[model samples]
Target: MSAMLEVVGLDTCYGRTQVLWDIGFSVAEGRTVALIGSNGAGKTTVLNTICGILRPRKGQVIFEGKPITDIPAHHLVGMGLVQVPEGRELFSRMTVMENLELAAYARRDGAVDKDIRGVLERFPVLGKRRLQISGTLSGGEQQMLAIARGLIARPRLLLLDEPSWGLAPMVIDAVFDTIKAIQAEGTTILLVEQNATQALAVADEAYVLEHGRIVLGGTAESVAMNDEVTRVYLGGFNPRGQ
Candidate 1:
C-alpha cells in the first residue's frame, strides 16, 4: 500500500529546546501504524508536528504525495488530515451535539446533520447524551466524544494521540476495539500510544521512539519480542499478558 503520510528527518523544537531529532516514519493507506514509547519520549511531539500544531525546524511532512511541511495546522483539516489530540479537548460548556457540529466548521456540505447522525450512531452513549454538556461526561465518554468529533470532519487519515490515557483497563480495551472498527471502515491511522502492548497488538507496523528519535522500527510482533523493548516498553510481558 502507498503511504498516506510520511515524515522524514523531522526535527522540531519548542523555542531553542529541540523535542524531536531526525524523527521519521510513515503510515500506509488502510493500515494502522503505531509510535510507542515512554513518557517524555517525544511521542506526542511527533503527532503535533504531523498535525501542523508544531512546526518542524527541519525535514518534511508528506501527505498524499505532496509536501505539507509548510502548511498551517488549520488548513490541513480541510485536506482530510484530522487529529484527536491527547486531552479530549472537548468544549466543556458545549452540548455534545454542539461540540460535534463545531468540528465541521470548515466543511461546506449541507448534509452535516445527516453526517452527525451517522457518527453518533456508532457511539450510542454519545447519541444518548447529545444534549448534555461534554464536560459532564465520564472520562471514557469524553474520549469517545473526542474521537466522534474527529470523525465528523470526514478524515482520510486520523492521527490518534494517547486514546487510552487515564482510562480503566476495560475502557482501554473498548477504545482499542473502537480503533479497529474505525480502521475496518477504511480510514488509515497514525497512532501515538504509551500502552506498548495494546498499541502493538493493533498495529500492523510500529516505530519505537526514545528521547525524541526512532530507536526501532519493524512489524509490531518483532518489536514486541526484542529483549530491550520487552524490558523497557512492555514490562517484560507479551501482548497477551504472557
Candidate 2:
C-alpha cells in the first residue's frame, strides 16, 4: 500500500523546550501503524505536530502527495487529517449529541447530518446517552464518545494519541476492538498506545520510540518477537516460546 501520511526528519518544540528530534515515520493507506513508547517519549508530540496542534521547526509533513507541514489545524481537518488527542478532549458541559455535532465544524460539504447518524449508529451507547452531559458518562463511554466525535468529521487518516490511556482491561479491549472495526471500514490509523502488546497485536507495522527517536521499526509480529521488545514491552513473556 502507498503511504497516506509521511513525516520526514521532523523536529518539534514547545517554546524553547524541544520535544521531538528528527522524527520520521509513515502510515500506509488502509493500514494501522502503531507507535509504542514509554511516557514522555514524544509519541503524542508526533501526533500534535502532524495535526498542526504544534508546528515542526524542521522537516516536512506530507499527506496524500501534498505537503501540509505548517498548515493550520482546522485546515488539516478539512483535508481529512483528524486527531483524537491523548486526554479525550470532549466538551464536558455539552450533551453527547451536541458534542458530536460540534465536530462538523471542519466539514467543507453537506454530509454533517448523515455523518452524525452514522457515528450514532456505530456507537449505540452514545445514542442511548445522547441527551446526557458528556462528563457524566463513565470512562469507557467517554472514550467511545471521543472516538465517535472524530468519526463525525469523516476522516480519511485518523490520528489517535494514547487511546487506551486510563481504562479497565476489558474496556481497553473493547476500545481496541472498536479501533479494528474502524480500520476495517478503510480508515487508515496512526495509533500511539502505552499498551504495547495490544497495540502491536493490531498493527500492520510498529515503531518503538525511545527518547524522541525511533529505536526499532518492523512488522508487528517481528517486533513482538524480538527478545528485547518482549522483555521491555511485552512483560518479559515470549509468547511463542511458551
TM per candidate comes to 0.97, 0.96
Model 2 residue 182 lDDT score? 94
Name the runs in model 2 displaced over 4 angstroms: 238-242
C-alpha lDDT values of all predictions: 0.92, 0.90
Clashing pairs counted in every model: 0, 0
The TM-score, computed over Cα atoms with residue i paired to residue i, of candidate 2 is 0.96
Backbone clash tally (model 1):
0
Off by over 4 Å in 1: 240-242
Give per-model CA RMSD. 1.2, 1.5
State residue 237's C-alpha deviation in candidate 1, in Å: 1.4
